[model samples]
Target: MTVANRFLSIDLEKCQGCLSCMMACSLAHEGESNLSRSRIQVFQNPFGRVPDDLKIHYCMQCEEPACMEACPAGVIYADTEKGNVKRIHTEECIGCMACITACPYSAMIWDLENQHPLKCDLCADTPYWNQDRPACVEICPMKAIEVRSEE
Candidate 1:
């Protein structure tokens, strides 16, 4: 099994918790600027810690994805071109919520409108916005997010 050369990386220290990445991701994938549809989420501490309390949450793109195994419909798959990034085949998904339960990090998000689960795919080469990178990384002003490639 070959490891992915390119992967998403985050620097929590630099995150401002503005959620620009979430907005960019939602716009790129869903054609709308809705945070509910975003794959990435920013969690802030209730105590109001400025930079330290912010945490960016998203798929880990596990080497052995539990979501893939737990899916009864076999909609979740690994993207070979992008280093086995776990992705969901939305059309094939049955909205069983198995993937949501299987995700250890609670990264799998439920889409109420689409009746399907959503996870980070590194913005895989889709016709909607076929770029070699993710929208979140591109739109992040603070440069807290990055696409790290093993060269």
Candidate 2:
């Protein structure tokens, strides 16, 4: 089968509120502990009844990402090789809040101490391909996620 650049998409229909994705996301991104540092967040709808309320939230990595355009520091860049991967050049960032504010999905967050933005790179810098999928996709006990090319 031919492969295309893509990300692991979580099926909200199957998520059980286990938060394994959040844990994995934090571990991979921060290289340390702290839930606030995690790029992916799970929220339960206060108004929804029972199971439908729970869902995992993260970047959709939109076809045209606002975060990339909003960064005044020019830290965010689309991966020329993979297209699907977006990267932030940490060294170039000036800790400006433009990108975080531009993200409609709230996928971006401020890294206070570092004074930089912290968000999901979808584990792109890691050795995820040789393994199964990203750590979040692999560790999801409910098997609620899958990686695929755009249709």
Candidate 3:
């Protein structure tokens, strides 16, 4: 299968435990400022610092995606037309949470309101689709997030 040439990269050292990335993601995608609607999440440690202080739940967009393999309805697919991004066809979804559980990175976000799973499509089909980069990358004040490509 064709993995995306462009994918996300994160520099945890530059992260300041800010929720900007999350807010931007939610707003751009769902037209809301809800953190739960955000595809990216910033998890901070209660008893640690720096590296341990953050566990970002942003999709790594793996070369061998477990979520794609686990989808029974075949709703999650690598969209070749959309930069080979792994995307979910919400209309075809069977409301199974297998993809969510299969993601080792915990990046497969479950949309509570929609009763479906949500993953980053590299901003290929978001409300802010015209931008050069994803909302998280563009709105990141610390530049903690970025998009990298094989090319």
Candidate 4:
């Protein structure tokens, strides 16, 4: 498959845990009412503790994805036809946490009630039909996040 250069890049140095990205992301995924169903998970070292600090986590949609390999259900697949967008087939997913464990970045979050893995899809349709970026990139008050060509 041909890899596309499109990606949503986060500049950690510029992020201050404002969580506008999370709010935006959740809203984008789950609509305005439900933030808990959002895909991305933000981590902090607890009270802004040292070493770990704060970071917003989400799928990088890697070229050689470990999460894709780890899933036994084959729920994960690449939209190689659509700019190499990696996506999870919601119907195929069995709520197993295999992909969640496989992710090195700890980007996966388990939806306890729905029993599904949650991660970023990077707003593929919005930017396709309209000239808008992902919601997280749009809502980030710090402007620390960016969506750009990886190349």
Deviation of model 1 at 120, angstroms: 0.7
Candidate 1, number of clashes: 0
Q: Score each candidate by Cα lDDT.
A: 0.82, 0.73, 0.83, 0.73
Candidate 1 regions with alpha-carbon error over 4 angstroms: 1-5, 126-132
Best-to-worst order by TM-score is 3, 1, 4, 2
lDDT tens string, model 1, 1-151?
6665556788987888888999988888888899989999888997878687887779888777899999999988877776677888899898889999999978889999989999888887543334355898888898888776553
lDDT: which candidate is best? 3
Model 3 global lDDT (CA atoms, 0 to 1)? 0.83
- In candidate 3, the residue pairs with backbone N, CA or C atoms under 3 Å apart (3 or more residues apart, or in different chains) clash, namely none
Q: Per-residue lDDT of 10-67 in model 4, one digit per residue for the tens?
A: 8777777766777777667666635566666666677665334976777787878899
Which one is best on TM-score? 3
Q: What is the C-alpha RMSD of each candidate to the true structure, in Å?
A: 2.2, 2.9, 2.0, 2.8
Q: Backbone clashes in each candidate structure, one number apiece?
A: 0, 0, 0, 1
Q: Between candidates 2 and 3, which one is better according to lDDT?
A: 3
The residue-level lDDT of candidate 4 at 22 comes to 75
Q: Candidate 4, 93: how far from true, in Å?
A: 1.0
Q: What are the TM-scores, per candidate, against the unseen true structure? A: 0.89, 0.83, 0.91, 0.83
Displacement of residue 105 (Cα, Å) in model 2 is 1.3
Question: Mind sharing the TM-score for model 3?
Answer: 0.91
